[model samples]
Structures are given as structure tokens and as C-alpha cells.
Target: MVGRGGVLRRTGGAVVLGTSLLGRLRRRDPGDAILRRAARLTLVASVVFFGCRYGAGSSTLATYGLFGTIAAGSFAQLPGPARRRARILVQSLPVVWALIAVGSLLAWSTWAAAGGMLVVGFVVAFAGVGNPRLVGLASAFQLFYILASFPPYQPGTLPERLGGVTLAVALLAAAEVFLWPDPVPVSYRQRLAEAADGIAAFLDATAGRLTDPHAAAVDRDTRRERAHDAVTAIELNRSPPASAPTAAGAQDRALRICAAALREVLAEADRLAADAPAEPIPDLAAARLLSSCADTTRAAGRSLSPGAPAVAAADLDGAVGRAEAAYPVGAGNARDAPDVPRLCRDATALALADQVRVFAVGCRVATGARLVGDDASSGLFEYARHSPWTLYWWQFRSHLAPRSAHLHSSLRLAVALAIARVAAGVLQLTHGFWVLLATLTVLRTSAADTRTALRPAVLGTIVGAVVSGGVMLLVDELIVYAIVLPVTMLLAFGVGRLLGPVWQQALFTVLLTVVFAQLGPEGWRLAEARLVDVLLGTVIGVLAGVAMWPRGAGHDLRYNAARYLAANADAVDQTVQAVLGAVPPPEGALDRVRRRMVLIDSSYCQYHSERHDPHRQQLNWDAVLSAGHHVLPGAESLLRRNPPGCLAGWPEAAALLRDSAGRLRSAYDTLAEEATHGGTAARPPVSTRCVDQLDRIRPLLGEADLESVRHLVEVDRWLAGLADSLTRISPPAADELVGHRRKP
Candidate 1:
């Protein structure tokens, strides 16, 4: 019912309202404010230009164009490094994009153009976006959209249309830098600091819970969550460019080191359960000391300059001493005691080592020393760049399991896309195209950015589409069409300026759909038909994603725990062999140990993601991993001290080591419960088995070289101390068992 003037007024009013609202919302942060104002201004400017070009059929396009420009411009506000990189990317992207657009234009067929756009989207999403998998998902939907609504070819027309789109994108990208400018570029350092804070807090809380056996599980779970966050933060910088390569590399190393330390802690906790005393130690001074160390580490993160000194040595010594007190001489070796405390201690030590390393790294950064490569030569450096196979297995092994949705896996995304496409075809629902849009909206939503992108995309699409429909309804003349062309340019500019890249795509889609719907042979009454197609695409996308879980990140916690146990078993075998006079550890043995460790780390990491798991698998896995540290070293020490008849009771030592391995394996089996409710109540008969093994080995060590034997005993004592430290960490569910479940 609206006339040309009425529609123009509505658009003008929208511009004014959007601008005003953007200004109010800009107050959240200076960066946000600048971006919003730029977006608003760009939208308004586009409207003015469109109004001058043609009576206003291009108003919607103008708005969307501004949105894209503003969104792109906002990348400039990221932090210096991020902004600089984005600039390079934006500048470089246009050249490639232009080439592709030209190719599509030359092809001139609707399917070709559509397919090209979809392909471009896929490439950009994969290579350009933060995560490559997301690119595949977005590309899949785009493909559907293009297939469903390929423009009918006209002679020599594809090039012109493609040229327009390319030009618009180029202009929008430029506007992102010049008009809507991001105040700060994203900073890897900031992310690292945040991650450190999470880890520090976790360690502090866990340390506080040492004395309270009842609070052990709670502390373990909480720490796991924090550690997971820290690792993710580190992963955020995985794809750093050359600008801050040293920093980026260091950050990566620091994160890995932290993860490794945490793993050691988990292993220690497991050992601690076997060595625990009957009555819980009420005085938690040791726990408090650890908490202090955590606080110091966090406090140090606030000033993230490199080359920072480690936490004061005196404080470190004091904390270590306090933690050591938790493992009384008899506590771990007690006949019926669980080894929880010693495991807790070991996990704490690993955490402390990480904290110290982080402190050192901060000092180095602060002092302008380029962080070095993670090699053996870099003494005490825990910041290795590459993760071990252990971490990798821990990360991907779970994908082997069947699940409805793999939240972070690419396979799930591909399957989802395929399903959505098939479903759309079967439904024969043109109006359901919005379903694809909805799927995109859902796909992008996460704990970090929430739904900020999806909301704008959906809104921009509707606005652009409705405006195109209204334009067709009002003016069907060739003159009107000619006038609308320049107006379209301005609208594209506005959308480019405002909504950003993701929303810009949506805006582009809406504009294209509207233009075709209006100029086609079909009348305005069929507008619903176009909308239906859009909806169908969106629906297909959602259904595809929901049907086959890609990452399978939603499994029960017990599976993750079991994986952790398996990793520990492998680590134990390797560590023992290495310590038992196996120099350089037989080809693949050392590599296997490291690989298993990484797997454990990754498994624990999954627990912290936004996926579905009722029992907090990450926490349980951390505990299990922490527990491994204690048992592994103990098994290794037994071999080292009793190496091939060097000691009076060398055979006894070997037998004892075997017994320990068996006990650990048994405990691993018991803790194999992936689900919260599946844990077995059976305990390991640790003392009886250990005594029998010791009795058998005693004759082999019958005082042949008493002096040499004494030296070996000293080694054993030191090793036991280390093992005892590990044992203070976790209460083994059974006295004799260790929960190692990996198959040899």
C-alpha cells in the first residue's frame, strides 16, 4: 500500500533509527563505539547517495552495502598486530576475489555464477576465517543457496553482474579499514594472558582442596575447566603470522608446557590415591602454599613483558617444602592407604613448573629477549612449539566413537551440509531457504562471541529482501530500473560499512534475491516463492548439522577418562623402558611417550569445550592424567635402581616393578568408566601383591655388592621421593590398583 515517497520515507527513517541506536550501543567500549558510529554514518551516507541517484529502489542495497563495509572496517580495530595482518589480508583478498568474480561473470550462467560465489565463500571461510572447518560449513550452505536460486543467464550479462559484486566487495573491504575502523586488532598476547589467569586460578583452587578429601573431586573438576580454557586460549594463537613470531611461538610453547605440567599433575594424583593415609590431613598449609604460587603466577600475567623473572626462589622453595609435607614417610607406603595426596602434590609440582616457566617467559618478553626455540639446548624451557602424539591421540581418538553430533569435527560439518542439501531437495520447499540462514546462525554461535553475528545477518537479510520487494511493487519501468542501478551501488557500500563480513554475505544474498525477484518475468505476487527458497536452504543446513555429530564432543566423561588411562599406560611403559638402561629409548619409544602425553592433554581439553557432557570429562581426565605422573616415575625408578643385577636384590626390584605395572594396569581397568555411573567398587590388592613380588626378588639381591647396592638404594630412595610426591595427588579408588587401561 506504500507509494514511492512512503517507501523512501520508511528507508530514511530506518537509516536515522539505525544510526541513533548504533550510537547508544557504541558506549560499551571505545572500539565498539567507533565501529558502530562508522557503520551508522556509512549507512546514512549511502542512503543520501542513493536518493540522489534514483528515487530510491537502491535504498535497501545501500543499507546492506554499508553494513558490509562497516563490518570489514571493524577488523582494523582489533589490536596492532591483528589490525596489521587484517590489512594485509584485506588488501590481498580483493585481487583474488576480483579474479574469481570476473571468471564467474564470464561464465554468465546462473549456476556458474552461483557455484562460483559458493566456492569463493568456501575458500574464504576455510582460509580466511578463524577456523577452517567453519569455512566448509558456510560454503556448503552457500552452495545450496546458489543451486536453489541461480540467476537466469542473459547475453553478455554475467560479466557485468559479477563486476558489480566484485566492485562492491572491494569497496566494502576498503571501507572497513577507512570508514568503520576497528580500534584494536586482536592480540595473541592478551589471549595468552587470559589463559594464564584461568590456569593460575585453577591451580590455586585445587591446592586449597588438598586436605579435604571430600573436596578433591570438586577441585579436580574446577581445575580441569580452567586448564582447558587456558589451552584454548593458547590455541587461539596457533596461526600467528611473522609480525610477532617469537611471541607467538613462545606463547604456543608456554601453553603446551602448561598442558604437559598439568598432565604430570594428573598422573601424580592417581599415584597419590595409592599412598594416602587413613585420616585426611586437616592442616592445609601445603595447599595454601600452592594457592599462593597460583596467585603469584596470575598476578605476574598482568604485566606480560618477556624475560620476567620466575616467582621468587624463596617462595618457590617454601611452597615446595609445604607440598612435600603432605607426603609423610609412611603415608604413601602405608599398607591400606590410597595415593591421592602424593598425586595431588605431583600435579601441583607440574603446575608450579609451568607457572615458573610462564614467569620466565614474561620476563624474557618484557626484557625484549626473543624467546628461543623449544629444543633440548634451551635448558628448562617447557615452551615447545609442536605437541606430542600423546596430545594428538587424546584430541582425536574420541572421534572413533559413534555419536549424533561431532561439535568441532570437520566430518560432522560435511555430513551436516550434505544432509541439509538433500533434505531441502526432498522437501521441495522454496520458502524454507531461510532454514539455511538459520543453520548458519546456529553454527556460529559460541561461548566466546555468542550470537552477535547471527542476529545482524538475519536482520540485514530481511531488510534487504523486503526493500527489493517493495521497490518492484512500486516502479516497473525501464527508467526506474536505470535509476535503481547507482542506488544499488550506494546500498552495497552501506552494508559493507556496517554489519561486517558475515552479515555482509547475508546482505549480499538478500540484495541478489530481491533484484532477481523484481526483474524476473515473475510478478510481485511470487515474492513469497523467493522467501521460501531462502528458508528451505536454512532448514537443510540445520538438519544436516544436527543429524551427524562431527566432533563427537558430547560423549560421556568416562570415555575421555578411559582414553587418559590408556595414554598413561603407554607413557608408563615407555618411561620404564627408558629408565631401565635403555639409552635413547629404542627408536620410537620416546616419541610414543610424548605422543601419549599429548593425547591425554587433548582428551582433557575436550571436557572444557561447549559440547555436551554431564560429568565434566575434562576434570576427570585431568585427575587421571595427574595420577599417571606418580606411577610412571615410580615404575621407571624401580628399573633404574635395580638395573640387571647391579643391586643385591636386583631381581626383587624387577619383580616389584612388574607388580607395580600390573597394579597400575588393574587400577586403570577399574577407572575405565566413561559414564558417571559405571565406576567399579573393586579395589586393587596392592600391598599383598607388592609384598609377594618383593619377597621373590629379595634372594636375587642377597648382599653381593653391598656398597654398589647402597648406591642403588639411594637412587631408589630419590626415585621413591619423586613417586611419593606424585602419590600425594589423588586417592586411588583401590589400594593395590593403578587405573592404566591402554593395550600394549
Candidate 2:
């Protein structure tokens, strides 16, 4: 009924809107990585599905083939270069085959299927603790098992189903290598190298500043920010793939600790550089120390690459010794008094020497001893060594604790999948896998988090249901459904994440509707069944969430944080004693602290994912984690840096250092106690006390080798960071702990 001009105007507007959308997509997905992936997946899926459905003339083959591509391509989230990803997929085939085989054997009854789901779901979810690649593939593995577990129990079709899956994976893996492959992401070692470079520059710049005190090209605060920024990049970018049970493992923990040590060095440098005179420097000892640290840190960084000249921890040790003999100790007020600017500079320089030595150990562990062989695979990487099963067993054993969110989440997943399987079986739904699919995708760590996402998901499902039902009612051409399926897939899978969870669910529903419509005879009733099954699954997911660990990691954040601090405090105590006796610190000290750190990271990750009540008090968890981060390295620095054991001639300094360690240990214990008992008291001096104590120790240094003061100053720097982090805890009130869960 419209005029030609009117129609032209409307069509022009549609074209403009589409163009705008395309522009936005380009901006959001920069290199079009999402589009590239969507296109690659679409081509592979279309070819596999069509060949099985029309060429092979087996509905089972077609169904498995299509879902196989979805599971592997969309769900697995394989990372790395295309060749590596393909290799990892090839290696995962045995596990996939076992899952399908077990799934077929268990689909005969509700009880068997539900029990299988419970056990299989737990194993797969819990396996993520082993490595990053395993975590990436977990959902795909779960999806495949769920697919074979629901309805039409036919062991006879296992061959076709398995063949179809193999075909899809084989083609997809080949396509991943040959097709438009993803650009290689920045490697973890590369990031570590970059961080080392940043630290080196900062230290070198600080040395220049120390040489010319009054005038500087760069500000101290600015240099510190740049160094910290690099550390942040390493934290965010590095995710080392444990490539083999023994062949894999990146020593990420070591890399992080090393990075932490470097960060500490920069901070200590800046603090000591504060408010000093601009005239010709009274002492070049501090300047030489900075230069040595810069050179040693740079060498360590270079060795992170595949083929760099090897550098040892001994190089750093030698550098410190040279610097110690580089300048004679002052004979005046500056000799023993830290309040004097000259002594303060010297003290700060010693602290840095301690941190750079820790940096050497970090480099050795991360580079697989290719660079520095002194401390490789000892403290952190010792347990995570060369056997895959050994690595897996250790990871598994470590995360088995009751407070681990990984354990709780695994349990929650098992329960939800089991309940969904039971519900689908009892209700006798024709396409029951949809029910399990809903439950698998929708359930969250806590009841509250699951409930938060429920409304949008349910609404999206209803909208999807209506649209799919309308498509079925209004259209009847068989060829039309087939023709549009791949197109729908491209848009759905590619752009879904760009939208929120609502659009993702809605598009997935539309995608499934088109898929099922082609596989068998169906009416609008298929759409009706999907809506009902999703609602049923949603209800089960929420119920299971409530029944299991209803509270997520935030509930245990304080407890775990406190526990972490206690372990770190103990590590410090043990290291100080070992240094005093000049022996290796107890081996168990590193192990306990490493284990606690892993637990805290897990808890912190889950805490962010969970839904918190708006009224609850916000905790400064970053500060707490940062504070805890300083503990082990600080202790290690103390143990490794001092040569003469400071216990001989420097009796007063040795006693003071020993006393300070006890005080820090007590302070950490008190902070842990407060964190445990509602965090009501202000944790004063956890942050600033060590810097203040550094002043007290400076005046008492009575005529000794300047290097003898290194161990105590390093310990103070560590304690200062630890105390600062502990004091930042703003814990929730007593009632807010579980208040969000008690909905009226």
C-alpha cells in the first residue's frame, strides 16, 4: 500500500542501521577475531552436517556431527596458535571417546543417567584444576556426555555417533590449522620478559636519579607507576598452559613471585629516594647498587626468551658483593643512624639488593633452568614437575579441601546435571537434552548468582520460543529451513557474546529450533517443549544451587585470606631462623604457603563471579592479596641475600632483626585472628610499621660491613607490604555474611 518513495526511504533507513551495526562490530572486535571464528565454524559445521544428513542418509550421524562441531568449536574455547589447538584437540580424543561410550551405556533409565551425570560432571569440572587448556575444554566434554545421556537409548547407534564425532573433530582440527587461523596470542614468557625489561628501565633510571640527586629527567612516582603497570600486565596476560603432565608447566607461580619481588624493589627504591638533597651525592654506594640490580634484572629478563644467554643467580650475588665493597661505610652520624639521609639511601639500596636476588630465583624456575640453574624447580615448581599424572595428582590433591570453591562448584554442577537428567526422564520429554542443556548453561556458583541471571534467561527463552514457534507455524518449506540454518548459526554464534546473556540464550533457542525442525517431524509443539523443558531445568538448577554450597567464595574469602596470612607469616619466621643458622628454610614452609596462595586465588576468582547484595560492605580484597603477595619472596630474599649470617659481629642488629621478625609474626597472627573474628578491630601498622622500624634499625648499625644490613632491611620492606595489605580489610558486618541468602 506504500508509495515507491516511501518504500525507498524505509529501505534506506534499514541499510543505514545495518551499516552502523557493522561498524560497531568492527570496533568492538577489532581484528574481527570473532567473525573469523564464526565464519570458520560455520563453514566446517555446514559441510559436516550436510555430508552426514544428505550424503550418508543417517539422522543419528547428522545430529552428532552438528552437535559435535558446536561442542568442540563453540564450547571448548581452545586457545593458542591453530596448530597447537589442533594438537591439543587430537590428544583429547580418547577422553571424548570414553565419555560417549559411557554415556550410551547409561541412558536406559532415569536413575542410571542421573547417577552417571553426577559422577561424570564432577570429574570433568574438577579436572580444570590441572591446567588452563583442560578448563577451556570442560564445557564441551560435559555437553557431549549430556547429549548421549538423554532419550532414545540405542547402544547400536554408538558406532555412527562416535564416527560422526570423530569426523567433526578431525575436520575441525584440520580446518583450525589450514583455514584462516587465529593470530598467535602473546606468550606468558614473553610477558615475563617484558616485565623484566620494564623493571630494568625503572631501576636504571633510579640509578641515574641517585647519581644526580637534585635534578631528574623522570619523576620517581612516575617510574614506580610504569613498573607497577608492567606487573599488572604480567598478571593479566600470563596463563601458562601446563602442556604435558611432565612436559608441560610454566612455573607461573615462580614468574609471579619474581614479578612481585621486582615490584617490591621499585617501591623500596622510590621510598628511599624521597626528600633527599639535590646536590652532588655524598655517597655513590646506593647508585652502584641500583646499577647492579638493573643489570642483573635485565639479564634475567633476556633469558626468558627461547634462546638467550644463560644468567645465574650467582651473577646477582656477585653483583651485591661487588657493590658492598664499592663504597666504605660512613664514620659519622650517618654510620649507624637511619634518620640520616646518607644512611637511609644506603639502607634502601640494600633492600633492593635483597629483592633482585629473589628475582634471580624466579627467573630460574620460570625458564626451566635454561637461564639460571641455581633454584630451578625447587620451591614452587618442585611438586609441579615433569610427569603429567604427577602434576594432575598434585593439583587434584591440593584442591580437595572443603573450603575450595572448585570443590563446591564441582559438587554443585554434579547435583544440577543429575537433577536435570532425572526431571527430563520423569517427564518423558522427547528432546530431553534441551533440559540438561538449560541446566548446564544457566547454573552458577551460588544460589544468589543463579537467581540473578534467571529472569533475563527465562525471558529470553520465552521470546525465543515464540519466534521459533511462529517460524514453524508460518513456514512449511523443508528446503528453506536447511538453507537458513547455517546463516542463523553464523549470526547466533558469532555475535551472541557481543550482546548480553539474554540475546545469547534467545539466539541459541532459535538455532536449536531450526536444527531440530530439520532432523525430524515436528510442529510448533517442539517450541512449546523447549520452553517447558528450559523452565523445568531452571527450577532444578536453582534448587540444586540452594541445596549445595549456597554461598560462593566471598563467604570464605575472609577465612582463606586469614589462613593465607598465617602461612606467609610462618614462612617469614622459618626463613629468618634458617638464615640465622644459615641453612635452607624448612621445605614444608614453601609448600604450605604455595598451597594457601592457590586457594586464595581460587576464592578470589569465584568471589568476583558471584552476585553480592548492594547493602553489604565492600572489602578491599586486592590490597589483602597484594599484601600476602609480599610474604614468601620477602622471606626468601632474607634467607638468600645475607652471606655472613649477620649473627657474628652485628650482635645488636641481629637481635633487632630477630625481634622484628617475631613482632611481624605476631602482627600477622593478630591480623589473621581479626579477619577470622568479624574484622572489627582496626589492623593498625600492618602497612607502615616496617618503614618506621627501618629508621630505628639504621642508628644501631655500629661499624660493620654495609652489606650486613641487607637482610633486616629486606625483611622490613616485606613486613611493611604485608601489614599494609592486612590493614586494608574492610570486612562485612556479622549479619551481612549470609544475609543475602535468607530471602523472605
Candidate 3:
């Protein structure tokens, strides 16, 4: 199989699996900046650590300096230009000092330390909601706090500790900027713009094929895969540590929604390509509409970046107006003959246009367009338009509830650390921090994730401990130990998480062993203590993960996802009723969808990150989640395309939509109900009812205006999309899954 780096790959599965870590390392690509960054980190560590121990003549300073350096360097997965990373580290000086000081004071007794961990852990983890950069810095802050908290109540030595950390932060910050500086990172906005360009190109190509007789066919699957890749790139890079909040946070946040909107456009375009009618679209106006959509996206792509030309909101509106006018009068053509395939083509084309409209609105909002009259006037930023801190504060405040996965994770970490601290203190473990360290590192958002990571980590730690112990016995010279320390730091910090957590944990254990040994006279018992404390931490972490999810997390995520599904179904009913002139479309539909999307994104992140058990019954979560994402967008698109009183003349067509929506909504309701009550959902019955509704619409299309026809098609397609997705979920899948037993 082809492997990473495209080096040392083997043909057979067995041979490839049999390859060693050494072999893998040999084939590994040590990127230009990473190794230099690691080397720079090593140099800083050596200076701070040895300079403190030998020159200053205090082991406390040495200990804090060494760990502080490590924490500053390795704790966070902060991505960006090196200068940006450096800026974040420099800005962290106050936080680092505060944590260290508080932790030292808390070390007065076991009771204090454990209690402090509860408050400190939650606060640290919870801070991530405001700014994602804090998420990475969280472990570092906690590590520093834990480093200070677990001790012989050495509050007097707090200055030495704080001084060491300050020195380390300064050195690391300098190293990040001046030494081995990282190349400027491509902005996620640029990536989103690029994705927009690709999707737009696909739309253009598809439209040409639809309108022109000689145009070549394009493959839908290839376009879908392309769009999928684009989405992955955007999603992965979008939240990379943001710089100091100016309007930057607000601007960046707007881009994020824009990215989401573009993602929908890609998804819709993919479906449009696949569902294109065999016969060329009879109405060239529909083809022209699709072409206009492509133009809209291209304009969006050009204008998304900060320096790009400012695009007026009216430009987009005018494009839509022109496309609307292009539609031929439906009088003579629709009077005699009913064209079902042609109507379906028109619907598919309109679906693309609807998604494009959403993207257009999103783009305008992102570009700071504040003049669309009503919905687009205040835009997505709304009240927080000028104030980024307000936005950050609100984001933080929103997740305070128990229902939020962010809160759950914060609580989970806090509780786990508190328990671990108490256990370490009561047991009188020599290296008490090791117990907390193990728990902090091993525990994840859920128990299942912890379980997945625990086995390999435990194995790797045991092996590393044995090797470390042997080194301690064999190497008596302090000179040798000092020399090896920087080398180990280089390998551990410089190299990426080598071959998952196994090598990572093992190498880290070894690296720490070297650092600790250099600081003191230790024997094999230190290694033995390390192993014991680590084992204790892992058990507590697993318990904590499970506790938070079902009180462990698996159950909570499913229920959360199910609630979104059920809500989307309700939204479907609302939009359909609104279309039928029964009532205005429900307000806050977008807000509800946005909240659900956020919850699912956070809750299932851990689940999606791990490899699933292929043999077991698992829900088609991707399908369910996609259906959830589409619901609000579909609602908005339907309502936007159909104005008030438009459906008054087409009562039969409106009824057709309402009836079909009832069946579609019922399927989702069943799935959601089953998902909430238990893990299993019975297979939703396939219905001919949608086809019957289409039959009802066929006669109406003959006499309806192009506007009416397009709206009718959009309504049908929206429900049809939901039905197709929901029907794919069955009892055979996710039957043994957990549902939230403790309802929030």
C-alpha cells in the first residue's frame, strides 16, 4: 500500500503492517520548518534548564524552566505563521504566571489542590469556547498549574517558578519569530474562496452541458469527490488560532458562515449534476439561471479576500433579477402539453440557484454588506457587528448550559483532574504530578475515545519506562544525561506525534525521564513510580469519559444529533405551511439550525476522529448529519424563492407540497424518536406518496408561470432530498448505540 511520504511503501498488507518504527521514521518527511522549530526549542530548553540549575543554583527554578519551555513549545497545536504563534505565546505571559501562582498557593494541602483543580480545570477548558487558540494553550496552562499544585506546599519558591516560566516564554517566543520562522500560512478564507471557485466552475460546466447541444458531459462523482475534498480543506483549516480580536474575529466569523454556505453550494451542485435530466432542459431560462449562479459564486470568490474589490449587494440582486426575467412566459408552452422531465430539470436548476443565493447572501455578509433592506441588512453578525469581544463573550456564554458539549468536556476534565489529584495526594505518590499528567493527557471528550487511546499508550509507556530505567542504571555521569536531554527533546517535540499516541506517549515518557534524571539522583523505582501513577491516571480518565458521555459521552451525542433531526423535521412542516400561505416561515429557523450544527460539530468531533468498528451496528451518522445541515438551508431557500400569496393561486400544488412534507416529516420524526428513546430506529417505510404529489404538480406546471414552476420544483426537491437521506438509516445500523440516558 502507498504510505505517507511516498517512501518505503510495500505491496502486501502483511509486509506493510510488519514495517518497523525505525523504517517509518526513515521514510518520514521532516518538513523544513518543524525540525528547525524543534531544534530551536531544544536550544532554548537547554539554556533555561541548565542556566537555572547550574548558574542560579536552584533545582526548583530548573524544574519549572524545563517544563515551562516544553509546555510553551509542545502543549498547543496552534497553526499559523510563526510570528502569529509567537505573538500568542508572548500574550500568554500573564496567564502562565497567574496559573503558576494560584497552583503554588493551592498546594497548601491535598484538599486545596484537588478543589482548585476542579475550578481551574473547568475555567481553563471552558475558555476555549471564546478563542480556539486557548484550546491548545489549555493543556499547557493545566500542566503548569499541575506542576505547581502537587508538591510539599512550596509557596515560598513561587518567584523562582514564575521567573523560570517567564524566561521560557520569552525565549520560545523569540525562537518562533527570529529562529527557523514558519512560512506565512494560506488563509482559510483563501481556501474557502478556492473551494468556491472549483464549485462554481463545476456549475458553469454543468450549465453549459444543460444549455448547449454540443457541450461534453461532466462526471458527477468526480465533482462530488472534488467538493468533498474542498470541504475537508476548509473545515480543517478554518479555525486555526485567530490573532488579536479586532474586527478580525467578527470578520473571521463571517467567513466561517460563508464557508458553511459555500459548502452547501458545493453539495447542491453535486446533486444538481447527478440529478440533471436526460433530455436537455426545455426552458433555456433554467440553464441561464444556473449560469448566473456560477457567475454569482465567481464574483463571491473574487470579493471574499480583504483586499479584493468591494462588490455591491445590488450586483447579486441584479443577477437574480436578470435570471428571473429570462424565464419565458409559461403561457403557450404549458397550455397544452405537460413536460414532467422538463419541470424536474427546472427544479434541479432552481435548487442550484437557491444554494447560490444563500452563498450570495453569506458572501455579502462576510464582505460587510449591510444594505439588503431586511434580512441581509444587519446580516449574520447582527448586534455584534462592531464588537468582537461581545461576539466572543456571547459564544462563551451560550455554552454555559449542561446541554453544551463544550461545558460537558470542561466539566469532565475538571472532575477527572480533581479526582486524580485527591487520589495522588491520599496515596502519597512520590511523583503526584505524574498521576494528574496521565489523567490529563489520556482522557478525551468521551470514554470510548479514551479506551481507544489507552491500550497503546499503556503498552508504550511500559516499554519506555523499562528503557528509561535501564538508561538510569547504565548512565551514571550527569554530563551524559545532560547531553541526551536535548536530543530527546528534539525527537519528541520536533517530530510530529510519531505513529499515533503510542510513540508519542512513549517518547514523552522517555524525554521526561531524561529531564527528571538530570535534575536528581534517581533509581529504577522512579521509573516504577512513573508506571504506577500513569496507570492510575488512565483509569480515572476512562471513568471520567464514560461518566460524561452516557456520563461517559456516546449516548449524549446521539441524542443531541437526534434532537437536531427532529427539529429539522419540524422546520420542514413550518416552511411548507408558510409556502401554502398558512403562516409566515418560523423565525429563528437559521439560529436553531446553527446551534444544532455547532453542538453536533463539537459532540461528534471525538467520535468522528476515531476509527469505527466496522463489524458492529452503527448509525449512518453522515447521512443523518447531512440531512440535519440541509434542513434550515432548504427552509430559507424555499421561502426566499416563493413570496407571500404566490401559492394562493396554486392550491393543488401547495397541497401536494404539504401532503408530501407530512410523510417526509414523519420519517424524520420516527428516526429522531427512536434515536432519543433508544439506539435503534426502525427502517422508515418507502412511500409512493412523493411520486403521487409530483403527479399532482404535473398538470399545474402546464399553466403555471416560470416563477411558480421554479418555486414548486424547489419545494419538492427540498423534501425529496430529506426523504432520500432519512430512508437510508435503519435498525441494522446503530442498534446497539447509546442514547442520552440523562436528559438535559
CA lDDT of each prediction against the hidden true structure:
0.42, 0.71, 0.69
Residue-pair clashes per prediction, in order, are 154, 14, 11
Model 1, global lDDT: 0.42
Per-residue CA lDDT of candidate 3, range 37-57, in tens? 678888999999999988998
Worst 10 residues of 2 by lDDT: 239-248
lDDT of 2 at 147: 93
Model 3 TM-score is: 0.82
On the 0 to 100 scale, the lDDT of residue 615 in model 3 is 51
User: What does candidate 2's lDDT look like per residue over 106-208, in tens digits?
Assistant: 9998899899999999999888776656666888898899999876889999999999999898989998888888788776667767877877887877777
Q: Point out where model 1 deviates above 4 Å.
A: 1-82, 91-149, 153-188, 191-527, 555-561, 577-590, 596-672, 675-744
**Per-model TM values vs. the true structure:** 0.51, 0.85, 0.82
Cα deviation at 332, candidate 2, in Å, is 7.2
